[model samples]
Target: MTPPAESCPALVLNADFRPLSYFPLSLWPWQEAVKAVFLDRVNIVAEYDRHVRSPSFEMALPSVISLKEFVPASRRPAFTRFNVFLRDKFTCQYCAVRFPTHELTFDHVIPRAHGGRTTWTNVVTACSACNLRKGSKNLRECGMELKKTTRQPTTIELQLNGRAFPPNFLHESWRDFLYWDSELDPW
Candidate 1:
């Protein structure tokens, strides 16, 4: 039986067959995939067993699709809460322990009240405990120090860091494109 449209998202890839983005695992809705197929914007690399039909045509839902043209990634990664955590690899800069996103918070190395601005250089990821401990105080006043100096990470750096944390849901077709660089473990 054909699955619902919502269940048939297509993993989108670049013309080179590499995923467009790794962190979020680029995907497109079945409708968009089908539209792209009709428009010649993307080539269907794989398909689901499910089929969608219209008055004149019927086609299988794409499971994986690749663009006809390559889209380059931005050179500069955006400075956002998520990017900040990713830049730090979700590790507390002060305590140097890895924490899940939920347990992590952004901290200013120099307290904002002390004239700190929320830029890539001034922000660091901290665990809840560390955040509260260092609350609104300068690093020296809190007697805490960052393991590494925070700075704006390049797009490539962010991409590398993002690879360490994969999305929770990965369709089987996406594995080959996503993990092409990883070495297989010996049995």
Candidate 2:
């Protein structure tokens, strides 16, 4: 069966041929990828079996595309809920158990009532049970110890952490570019 054009998202890579992001698996909808192709902003690293057509033009959809120019990584990552989870590698800082995003929550090491600000250095990812148990109390009071010290993660650190998680779907062509950095076992 022919997959719809919408199902064929193109993996997007920087000029260095690394994905722009990993956890989200840097991708562009077929429409945007085709537009970039027409605008000459990206090079098609691979093409899908699917093709799109107009009255006068038809082109295979891009499965992977690389930008013509490199995009630099940010030095500082944003202090957002998702970023916090990524920084902690989606594990509960107290229990050291991994959970899906929906099951995870952020907890302030020093509860707000105790004058803790919601900043990177004071926040850690926690599962619901951990969050509730630690609610409105300091770690010492709750008898909880964080698996790791809470601190702001560098953008690069977050990026590397993000790579530890791959999106559920990956087109075959993207595999090489996505995991080239992984060390191979010796024969």
Candidate 3:
């Protein structure tokens, strides 16, 4: 039996056949993919066995699609909580242990109470324990050391870090595009 329409999202690729974005694993709903196909904006690279039908025509659901025009990546990445966590590889700067997003919180290298502004250079990822332990205290006073220095990450750097953490669900066809540059041998 065919899966539900929502389950058959199409992996979206740029004109060059690379994914538009890796961290989010670019995808479009079947409806959007079909519209793009009809609009001549995208080429269907692969299809599912299941088909969608209208009054006059029927077509297979696109499992993979590539754009006809390439879209360039942004030069500067946004300074968001998630991006900060991703930039730090989700590892706590204080304890150097990786934690899931929910368990992680960002820290100000210099406490805001001490005039630190919430910018990329001043923020670092920290666990709940470390956050509380270093509350309102300067790094030197708390005697806590950061695993790595904090700074704004470039879009390319964030993308490279994001590659280490793949999404939970990956369609079989997406594996090739997603891991094309990964090492073959796991030595």
Say which candidate scores most in lDDT: 2
Please give, for residues 1-187, the per-residue lDDT of candidate 1 as tens digits.
6568898899999898977777766888888999999999999988888899889989989999999999988899888999999899999999999998899999988889989999999999999999999999998888998999989999888877887788877767777777844689899
Best by TM-score: 2
TM-score to true structure, per model: 0.91, 0.95, 0.93
lDDT per residue (tens digit) for residues 1-187 in model 2:
9889989999999999988888767899999999999999999999999998999999999999999989998888888999999999999999999999999999999989999999999999999999999999998998989898888889889888988888888788888887744578899
Candidate order by TM-score, highest to lowest? Answer: 2, 3, 1
**lDDT score at residue 84, model 3, on the 0-100 scale:** 93
Kindly indicate the candidate among 2 and 3 with the higher TM-score. 2
Q: Pairs clashing in candidate 2?
A: none
Order of candidates by lDDT, top first? 2, 3, 1
Which pairs of residues clash in candidate 1, taking residues 3 or more apart in a chain or in different chains? none
Output the better candidate (2/3) by lDDT.
2
Model 3 scores a TM of: 0.93
After TM-score superposition, what is the CA distance of residue 148 in candidate 1 from its true location, in Å?
1.4
Error of 2 at 164 (Å): 1.3
Global lDDT of each candidate: 0.88, 0.91, 0.90
Question: Model 1: how far is 20 from its true place, Å?
Answer: 1.6
